[model samples]
Target: MNVFQSLVSSWQFWAVLSALAAALTAVFAKLGVKGVPPDVATFVRTIVILVFVSSLLFVSGQFSIVRSLSRRSVGFLVLSGLATGASWICYFRALDLGKAGQVASIDKMSVVLVAIIAFLFLNERLSMLATLGVLLISAGAILVAVAD
Candidate 1:
């Protein structure tokens, strides 16, 4: 299979890619927020993301699906967008005020919260091993946050 097809077929590949991108995001955002207000930085970043993603949607013909989306779907998507904007604003502020490593470690704790929320609200089930893994991740994040 082609490299594109191989990547599309592998969840591990996407996860690793996302991790690398997130690492770069922290580093780049730390630099970008220097001397700039976090809110402004977030706004600029959001504009860039909107342009890039809109371009992707147009190029991939996904824009056609927008007209068919239900109002509920659009509302949920708007809510998600607002949440993402809030997250970026807070993340930029944290990076501006603290070391990126510490801030990112604390941010990683969201994974633990997401798992718990999914289990409770979405009726998602976690096996014993998965629960242990989440606990370990939480501990590691805490250790990183508290470390000198």
Candidate 2:
């Protein structure tokens, strides 16, 4: 098999693993938020991620991926990681402070933000249905946020 085919074949494996990871994160955030401040919970969660990634490097024998990193790659990775950490902190804090359905619905509207940013900056085109869907998502987020 060629390289592309080999990579494509393993997508399902990665998807399942990612789903499980997301579920566990939600569970831990909910449970951990009961007593700890959101910032502290986020700090602990980030520390856990650092340890998990370190373990994966050793287990997968891909620890050398870090060695070949260029200056730009390292900068981007650190920025992306920090952005995700902030997003998760806000996400868990929102969930802790509000109804799950409301929080989730609002968060789901980030797709619209992605589309808007792409359209403006990347000059991407959106179909009619996609435009309508974005409107619907905004309305839904408003309703969900104010519902409870």
Candidate 3:
């Protein structure tokens, strides 16, 4: 199989691509925010993302799913979108004033926060190893954020 077929077959491929894209986002946003306010930059980015994803949804016939979403689902999605907007604004501002690696490292502490929040709010159970993994990730994020 060619590389495209191999990547399509791997479940992990999407995560890897997401990581790469996220890294590029930081770099590009950092550059784009050089003279612009972070909030404005985020707004522009959000518009671009909205258009791109909306196009994808229409092209892939996924827009039909919207009508099936219940009020609760729509409300939760709106809340999530607001949270994402806030996160992007903060992330872009952080990138503007800090090194990308340091900013991104600190941002990743959200993973640890998510694990704890999931356990507490979602009642999601983590195995001992997963708990340890969260602890390790938390420690590493702290170390990276504080490193000279």
Highest lDDT against the true fold, candidate = 1
lDDT of candidates 1 onward, in order: 0.94, 0.81, 0.90
lDDT score, candidate 3, position 125: 90
What candidate 3 gets wrong by more than 4 Å, as runs, is 1-11
- Clashes per prediction? 0, 0, 0
Worst 10 residues of 3 by lDDT: 22-31
lDDT (10s digit) by residue, model 3, range 45-140: 989999999999999999999999999999999999989988998999998898887898899888888998998999999999998998998889
Better of 1 and 3 by TM-score: 1
**lDDT digits (tens) for residues 1-148 of candidate 1:** 9999998899999899999999999999999999999999999999999899999999999999989999999999999998898899999999999988899999989899999999999999999999999999999998998898
**lDDT, model 3, position 52:** 100
Candidate RMSDs in Å, in order, are 1.4, 3.7, 2.2
Better lDDT candidate (1, 3): 1
Q: Residues 1-148, candidate 2, lDDT per residue (tens digit)?
A: 9977887789786788876766566666776788678888888878988899899989999988889999999998999888887888898788688766667677767778989999999999899998998899899888978896
